[model samples]
Target: MTNPQLLWLRKNLFNTWYNSLLTIICIAFLIWLAKSIIIWTTTQAQWTVVQVNLRLFLVGRFPQSLYWRVWIVLAIASTLTAITWGVFSSKQHLTKRQIAVYTFIIAGFLMGLPGDLTSRSWLLLISILLAIGFGIGRKFPKIILPWLSLTWLLSFSLIIWLIGGGLGWQSVSTNSWNGLLLTLLMAAVSIVLSFPIGVLLALGRTSNLPIIRWFSILYIEIIRGLPLIGILFLAQVMLPLFLPVDLRLDRVVRAITGLVLFSAAYMAENVRGGLQAVWRGQVEAAKALGLNSLLVTILIILPQALRAVIPAIVGQFIGLFKDTSLLSLVGLVELTGISRSILAQPQFIGRYAEVYLFIGSIYWVFCYSMSLASRRLEKQISQ
Candidate 1:
């Protein structure tokens, strides 16, 4: 090889060697640091008492009888995951790094020396569900839609069954609800409820009728103007007064309703942006082709509009996910609420650092993943 080629080869070799050596050194240092910290903390701190009450931190005072309900919900959620994977199988692919990160997360949940009151069974079930969902998504992409629909239907049915059987919703009161379940439920419900309402609001905003446009504008502006905490307060305190005396809403429902309304306002704005971005010529072309306005908007415009704004919608979702923590302020025990409540316990006093760190890590993982996914979608759409 020429001198230039030799230099290139040497550069590549040096780069590889440098990276390998750095990685090895970093790993060794991390292991040593972790060992030293563990020794110091265990020797100086009283962790055994905390470990014994770990279950309280994880699930709070959930009734033992309703533990099965939580598991059933988890199973249903797993099935839903499998179905979703099936529906979007064509679009699904996981990088090795993603797999490694997920594996590490599972290992942490399973092996981390948390309080001895941990629910190993619940963790086990979630792991199995995730594994099965991933396998099906990878192997049977075509069946995803039907599978997802079936799982959703089953879940809804289960929800109805639980409520009707007089199992009573109080078994899992809004105050007692905490941890990952609350976070997932709030996010899932907010997204589900907001999308249609957002679509309607978007359409109304763009409608030619003055009344429709005015109403839509008013609703969106007023909702968007208020802080989420204000809306949450309305939902928790004021909205209940408007309800019939016989019709009492649960705190969780109120919080979810508040979230859905608050999120829909933002989602409407995003959808409207997408709609506005669609070329007027496309609408005119559809009209000239003898398509009615409804068909034109629905068939020709909305799909592209939605696709164009998916990243924005995803951004809104991630924001909503984080905002769900605010429900803690109104006495709803979501993840942050749970962590704060745990810290208030006499035994866990002064352990706010550990608890908050763990909670922040969990929130960071979820929000970061959502942000990454949104960026990936943006890239794909731009391409």
Candidate 2:
């Protein structure tokens, strides 16, 4: 090989006077930025606050006794993750480096905590076990995927019960939720629960029936036209009043409800775009083959419509995840809110940069993962 690295450098960096100068300036800036980051993290940053409050960062003030239940939920999620990967990635074998990185990550959790086996450690162990579960799940009937989605739905319901305390469990109120737990809970719950609602709204908007289409259009427009924060405010202040005297809407539930409704309106629009992108020929062919209108829409149109909008749907999901931070504005302490609370504490009064950076990184990781997954799915669908 004729030194491909040097060739690339020559072509890209030294091709012109401006190019070489610009590259040198960028390199110098990057080196300076790297040094600053290293110095701040090693010597200036007060990491002890973060370490001490890690649990609060992860779960807020969720009772320590209930911590095990959250871990169990994580284990279930890990198993589901493994099963999904095994099913979808059967043709895409993991590289040795990929396997090693996964193993290292799983193993790192074993020693992440000070204890030999803490809740986090145990939860991480389930990830290792997930590989085994994936093998078993992948061998099941191909029809298991839908059932698996239902399983996840049930699992999510169970988690809500476990955390919020109903059905003979200790009654922890929704107000107690905070930190990353609250953020993930609100975002995940809204995304899952809003999907079906969004689909219905989308269908209604596209329906031949004038009343249904008009109503859907009105609702989607009203919700989308208003700011999300305003909706959250309406949900918080107005929801309880709308209920019977004996009923009360939990603050956490209100926040989630507002998010679901708001996001569903956006989701419905994304899905409508998908519906439009589906070819007219597909519907015509289905009808010609003796499929009824309902069958044609459901069997022939819906999948193509949905597949076309997967990227937009995932983008909405990322937006919804970021929107969870707004719950903090309404006085529900999610990850960002919790960080602000900690920063307001007398001892950490001036640590804005450190705390906000940590909060931002957490949000970035989740959003980035969804973004990357959407790209992968878009590729798969195109293929």
Candidate 3:
């Protein structure tokens, strides 16, 4: 039998002379581009730059002896992700395809790490353990679910101590934090902390209490009115001034604070839109059923409202992930900042393209994963 793909291509691409010509030219260009990229990457490009600077790219100037702390942080994250997937996924399984895709994609770059054979083995072990963790959580959700949130909360505090030190360990100043680790920390912390604040702000904005509503309105408007960079600058410049000298927040903490506050304001608007999308009839229906205001909102209104706005929430999360790069403006060296550090090195001078490309690719993969997850969630919900 004739190939199905070939028949479809003929129908779509060869239906007319102009269409056939266009398709041929496009195919030729793609092939040429692919060949050029392969040649450059394999022959001309100095990928050794990436391999040599792996530590700087991943963790910046963070001390090497303290690297185990990063592994523990990763384990905490892996467990939390497993539990989350087990709790929320329709299949009672973490989506293996997505996890595998990201794992291998990252491994491709990181596995080549020079002189890091043992660490690569550990990385693979962690990946396998994460899958096993997901299975354990999924199978014993009734027994395990209660501890999941508590574990995450504890892990949050533990991560801060491990990364920043000072909890029975040597104090590692936040100023030394940089690289992809810092980028991810800021993004994750901002998104996590922003959620509860956003929910409260959303509820307050919709409250019948005029004072509460107006105060909520004021905060959201004031924060949202300014550019995020301006807010970040203010946080960088102003936060330390108000604190007693001994209590001054570290630069990373200040950046996180600024990100959370700015993101919460935007997220409040997203949540408010979600809240608004709930029909008046739904509220009335719950009220008619003798439900109190809080019960009506909690049991009837919120679930539907949030479900309707999943895409918007995900979009905001992706934006927050990318916006974390803005911390470089305040002298915090996250991914983009780390890239600049690499470029500034005498040995890596004129390698701006490689460094920037690597940084951009990292950002792209993370943002793209969020976008894909959002779409998949929307599809699942609609179905």
lDDT of 2 by residue, 125-203 (tens): 7857776666655466366665877788888888787778877778876667889989988999999989889999999
Report the Cα lDDT for residue 61, model 3: 92
Q: At residue 192, what lDDT does model 2 achieve?
A: 95
Write down the worst ten-residue block by lDDT for model 1.
163-172
Task: State residue 196's C-alpha deviation in candidate 1, in Å.
Answer: 1.4
TM per model? Answer: 0.76, 0.92, 0.88
Displacement of residue 24 (Cα, Å) in model 2 is 1.4
Per-residue lDDT, model 1, residue 261, is 90
Q: Which one wins by lDDT: 1 or 3?
A: 3
The residue pairs in collision within model 2 are none
Q: Candidate 1, residues 101-189: lDDT per residue as tens digits?
A: 87568647764544234356566666767766766666766555445555675677675455224555544455656766677778877
RMSD of 3: 3.3
> How many backbone clashes can be found in candidate 1?
5
Local accuracy of candidate 3 as per-residue lDDT tens digits, 261-316:
99999899998999998889978888988999989888988888789888889989
Alpha carbon lDDT of residue 257, candidate 2?
A: 92
For candidate 3, which ten residues in a row score worst on lDDT?
A: 85-94
